[model samples]
Target: MTQPLLPDVRRPANGGPKAAARNRAALIVAAREIYAAQGLDAPLSAIARRAGVGQGVLYRHFPDRDALATAVLEENVRQIEQAAAAEDMSFADILGVLTWHLKESAAFLGLLHMRGSVDHSEALAHALALSDRVERALRERLPDGHRLGAANDLMLAVAMVSGAAGGPEREARERRAMAAWRLLGVEVGTVRPFDA
Candidate 1:
């Protein structure tokens, strides 16, 4: 038999119920907000209460906060992958996608920088795979003169603040975003100066 163009991989056949996706997504958001406010010490029961779902229902969907946290990150990763799917964008446009990703996902990054782990290791693995896709999109989007090194630099710059500062230090984070813009080749310097 001739080999097919792409390798086959096994995954869940079911995407799950549309309503369930919405509901689980809501639970993930609620957990993130509560966890951001109180860290992981916040009770799952309280999260269930805040989510307006019975404890069993919450457990059925997430089983534990670990699963819930992973789900949140996964959702963000999915969006990033989707947005960066374009392979023909100009370097600047591609860079814009990176900036928008980490900015819109500031809270998600905050959770990651703060929480750092989830029970299901596979979730984090999937997140990283999605990141690779983002990088690929960036490389494909860059102009003829652009070096891959710039893409790496942009990734680091975005992480420098969000992955480092996170939390109530809103001003500093904004500085990081602006710095990231500059690093991505925009001429503007730190719009609001601040230390890392």
Candidate 2:
């Protein structure tokens, strides 16, 4: 594959591949924490400070703020995928996992939505691919109901969570939406044809 548009800085004498990897990981963690506390508009310098790394180190791993946000979001999506794939997890369980991630990563999600048009286009593609995979997996486990595909219901659930603020309000909003899905029979571990 072609090289990414943003490349890391060349390793110095004291820093090798291992150091680069560690720095990259640290940047992601710091970005998540900083973003959660201060929103996506928080300065990149703040994230660098939180990671205990210099601004140059942060820039080496992620050339721009969008790059950093994408890295954080990619990690979040991977985690949600793993949660959904857990043994015996129902659709409701999967939605819970998804919303929880969404709530926690609201800043990143908002950043993506606000910067939807351009910039970080590749990251946007990767995020969409990850989401599509999860949705397809969930769809396979859901039965056709009300002539709607599982993906449709999944989108609606996402829309519901999109309006939610962080903290208890987020959980409450997701719970209400899940309850509505239950009423509509848009869940797994039910009398759906797939389970029969």
Candidate 3:
């Protein structure tokens, strides 16, 4: 009896191009959670596990830690851009979003320090654009006589919020960010003059 040989059937790899977008989204979400919980140096394997994907899928989406961090930051910037685009959202509102992200994601602060790296250039550009947009909104909202040094003051306010985000406790971080915003004459939920 001659037995016919059956053709070998192989399953497609986990992260085929069809799945690349989905896999990448999953990886980014996982990275956000893992990084927020364990900081930027958290194991890549942990991210893969959290994403329910394999290491190969993670590598395919993010070539390295910096690449993943950049993606995470880009996502953050995208969020800020959305807030900036809202007609009713004030500069203070956008700053609140930025501070919330910084407080929740340790990687955001870590990657902000890596602005010198080429991998983060896109995120940096987007951030700078958002900064310009927010600055414009701030300028528009400022008292007519207080427009002087608006740009410098906005940058200082951002720096203060970022610096305050390094604290270990969430409540403390929020308090510090609020104080910094107040020092810059911007309130968390409202924008007001320094003396007002």
Candidate 4:
């Protein structure tokens, strides 16, 4: 018995169609690995392999690499909604959670670097509505100072930390991200271990 050498294109039998978000999310995560290891040179077949799905499933979910990359990114930002999970809190708590999310998104940033495309403009635009919601969430938690700047800084910082130019190396990116976290009033790592 031999497995098909060719990319499997069929989806697993599902009597009930899974939610699009979930299916796409699995594909997106798998694609991220493919893109990261291959640095956008990864083929759809490669992604299918990494995803443990069929080529047909890959194609059905994402028509091409660009679409897959787009989906990968969309999932990245979508992951940030957890920042608002700590509803009804002080500004400090709100900032703390958002900052922690910045680190959480670090892996996604690596994926973005691997994708190496500037197609996130549309995604960013779409996130604006959510951005407003996020800002409002932060505002609700803050007091007189009410630094809405944290919202802006957080978005940019996460993007920067995840971006290629954000840091020369992983350690540097972490340090920079933590610094940005502090600036945004988002609590993060207490001290650089290097000091030890």
Candidate 1 residues 1-196, lDDT tens each? 9977887778756546975776676787677556655665678887778887778878989877667766666665555455445444445544444444344444456433432455446755665555555556555544465443554564454455456435444456556766655554553321321111
What lDDT does each candidate get? 0.56, 0.63, 0.68, 0.53
- Pairs with backbone N, CA or C atoms under 3 Å apart (clashes), candidate 1: none
User: What ranking of all candidate models by lDDT puts the best one first?
Assistant: 3, 2, 1, 4
* Better model by lDDT: candidate 3 vs candidate 4: 3
| Count of clashing residue pairs in every prediction | 0, 0, 0, 4
Best by TM-score: 3
lDDT of 4 by residue, 23-127 (tens): 666787777656555555577887787777778988888887767766655554443344434454444554444443333333345443333344667655444
Which of 1 and 2 is ahead in TM-score?
A: 2
- RMSD in Å for all candidates: 14.7, 10.9, 6.9, 8.5
Tell me the lDDT of model 1 at 1. 100
lDDT of 3 by residue, 1-196 (tens): 9999879988866655768898898999899878877888999999999999999989988899988987887776666666666676765576677777776667666644443446646657765554455456445554455523444665555655677767666667667777766676665653211110
| Candidate 3, residue 161: how far the Cα is off, in Å | 1.3
lDDT of 2 by residue, 10-90 (tens): 855877788889889898888877776677789999999998899999988898987888888777766656655666776
Badly placed stretches (over 4 Å) of model 4 are 1-16, 19-23, 36-41, 85-172, 182-186, 189-196
User: lDDT of model 1 at residue 122?
Assistant: 70
What TM-score would each prediction reach against the true structure? 0.58, 0.64, 0.69, 0.53
